[model samples]
Target: MGRTGGKGLSLARRLYTSRILGLVLGLLCVSVAMYPLDPPAWVWAVMLFNGLVWPHLAYQWARRAKVPYHAEHRNLLIDAFLGGFWVAAMHFNPLPSATTISMMAMNNVAIGGARFLLAGAAAQLLGVGVGLVVFAPALVPMTTPAQLYACLPLLMLYPLALGWICFRQAYTLGLHKRELLALSRTDSLTGLLNHGAWKDQLEVEFERCKRQQTGAAIALIDIDHFKAINDTYGHVAGDIVLRQLSKMLKQNLRMADVAGRYGGDEFCVILPDLPLFNAVQAMEALRERFSFLVYEQNPALKVSLSIGLAALDPAQGDATRWLDDADQALYEAKAGGRNRVICCSDDKPRREVFDSV
Candidate 1:
């Protein structure tokens, strides 16, 4: 159920209505369960007045300020104030009404018991405070010390239970947030880091390389003549090629390596704590895998990759330089011939000649 907040009606209205129904039903249960313990008529009158006043004020406030209330915010100010009213009203009657406070706390737990625990605890505490204020005179008039001491436990217990429940809910919410963050950083198609996520990861990897006094390797990969494949066959065939290439890279890479799609047919691999020799070996494995993969559309037609690799110098202090060098090496590979790996080193010309057919 929903309602409008200066827009079309939202499901918030239905949800709000349902919460109200639950609250009313809970009160009815408490009333019935505490049978023969009815409070004075004056106490009922005060509760009736409060039932009208608090909701009316809340509705007017929601209307004027355009607050959206639903299950999520069901225990917001209005609900808290109403729950407080229950405590104070019960003071006048002092019927067996502990259930009201318990019900308010339970309502929050039903929605997301962990995420909104603090708010629920706060609400419960507010109810406790109201009960104290309402029962102050009653406490003074009690003839026996046992009677006063008996009520003391409930005063402390309500908020304590609420606090524990809220803490559990909050811890669960934190775990869920972490899971969501990981999913957001992952690429759905290639099972690699997305471009934006890769940049952040590269920065961390670069820092780690600098601190550990280790060299890192960056490889830029381009599927050779990918556009021709898409043009010749349909997009489905093109998608199959991309998926196959991604699978080849994943299968060939080591556990420490990270791969990401740099956009279009280009992909980047970050090899942390790797020297030039090992990086070359990894690229060789990828090339070998590519050579063996049979295209589903045409097994006779071969597919290949052009790769550029560069080893980073810790003294350079620029991760971007390594990527530029690798990109330049890739450009050379594509120019000389595809299906080859080229290296970029200061001592070398940053190029490797590939034999083109």
Candidate 2:
């Protein structure tokens, strides 16, 4: 019931505005046909209630029900029944009767597709039966000019309104799908690409550099003693430190550079179309800039980065190997000291370590 209600409640709400428009237009169409036949005072009163009051009442009924979706379905069948009843009461006038039945069918199909259409048809048949018992079966074959004009507003306008509603729903669902996809790829804390998304882009960068025989580089950055920061300061303070690093990455990196939170206490960057020398310089500048950031919460709280860089190696077959190379350089940076940039080169046997004083 809970699951059913979750789906059903929205159905009722979505239908509410459509119901108001459809029923009001249908009333105008049905009323014209019934006018010629001279319905009794009670019939006229019933028509008014169905046209004006029933839409609101049906909405409330479905909305308040435990299984709102089921309640709304019931409300739609009732709508079909009323449409049939009106057709019979009007002596089955051609234009108005067809308009009323088609409008109801359109509404039913939009709600539940073919199955609901069949169910609505059955309800309409039952309504016709009851209406026949009350008013006696009679056929009015010809449609007057006035009746045709009355039905025109319903025939033309209601479909446009319903179509627009469906369009709006489709557009909104598409927007939500795009947003969800972005959230899935992003790290919630750092707002950088998540581990998986970053790796995927690394693969693309590796292929691009290898195929073109162009130089690029990948960097692994570790927040020095990050766990100690959480242990010394609160986790909240540790989180702020992490966010600070991400902000600096965005500010320092070029648009072509891809950055991501590789894992706990570690970030990664891919510098496309950049030589090994320039990549090292960029990492060094970033390292220096980050070392100076001061937190307002803890003015004395200071932090630094350990960076390891690996240039694109055509000899390296896969992205993981490239990542592993950077990881090894990062290990060396941490081993050397807490605040410096270390460049790992495929061309050289000895790695270059830049220790900032």
Candidate 3:
């Protein structure tokens, strides 16, 4: 598969420091075991280069690769191979050998989970086989005092570095998830909660009213003659009008009010812990202020709103019935006149009109 942008590069950068630290420390662990063996001049030189120089070369290799993520994985396998080679070079001294291989296992699991761990193990075995051929492999079960102390830095500090890296990765993922959730709930056009989110809030409000015996109101608003506006003055102009209404809703409503785009040219608001008469006054004020907003696209292009309101009735069964009442009142308002607020009632007329001045 083709590598996506920067994924491999990011992995390489994250591992670079840990790689340098581990290799240098591993050199110490291996050197103590190799000392008694009286290894030749070339073997000591190779050890120094592998410990002090190889990390920089590996970083450059990954950075320059066309697919940095894939390149980094190859680098990890190479490290595993070298780790096993050193264990054999040390003649498999018990403490140093276990320490070296276990650290390599931790890194493989941290980078790519179990699958990569197994792959690293295979690479290590191959390295051990090559070492046996090249160096006449021998096993030394005892760990002297010097070898034990040399292994301590790699054993103690490498895991701490690896652990910190893992924690940072998890934290970054958490932040991305939160951003995605916000985008999912919000309407792109008006920057308000979308229809479904608002409706969810409505259901919560409904249950609250029923449980606490508190008052709340629902308002369903429609832009009057919206299609005519779009036809006469382009969809862009119509969109400007919609945005203007949404801006007014956000600015005028109280913090407790839940407003959302009910879907194209229509909007909804839930006023919690508010009385019926107050909600009507609030809607009327909004209608009047919105009527006076002059559009920059066409100064002559005037806009108006028709809103329908329904207050909480303890007798109401669910959120749907409450919304239906407001929808019916909105229909009544449009039938009565273009610009007005209609309040749904249980009385004889079943609708009360509040005309715009």
Pick by TM-score: which candidate is best? 2
RMSD of each: 7.8, 2.9, 2.8
Please tell me which model should have the higher lDDT, number 2 or number 3: 2
Measure candidate 2: CA RMSD. Answer: 2.9
lDDT order of candidates, top first: 2, 3, 1
Q: 1-357, model 2: which lDDT tens digit per residue? A: 323355588778788998899989988998888888888899989999999999999988887787888899999999999888888888889899999999999999998999999999999999999999999789999999999999999999999989988998889989999999899999999999999999999999999889999999999999998999999998999999999999999998999999999999999999999999999999999998888999999888889999999998888989899999999999999998769889888798689989997
- Reference-based lDDT, each prediction: 0.65, 0.91, 0.89
- Clashing pairs in model 3, backbone N/Cα/C closer than 3 A: 8-69
Candidate 2's error at 154, in angstroms?
Answer: 1.1
Total backbone collisions, model 3: 1
| Per-residue lDDT of model 3, residues 184-228, tens digit only | 888988988899999999999999888998888999999999999
State which candidate, 1 or 3, has the greater TM-score.
3
The runs of at least 3 residues in candidate 1 whose Cα sits more than 4 Å from the true structure, single-residue gaps closed, are 1-68, 71-161, 164-172, 297-301, 346-357
Clashes within 3 Å, all models in order = 10, 1, 1
CA-RMSD of model 1: 7.8
lDDT for each residue of candidate 1 in 260-324, tens digit (9 for 90 to 100): 88888898999988888788778877876787788756776577888898887755567777778
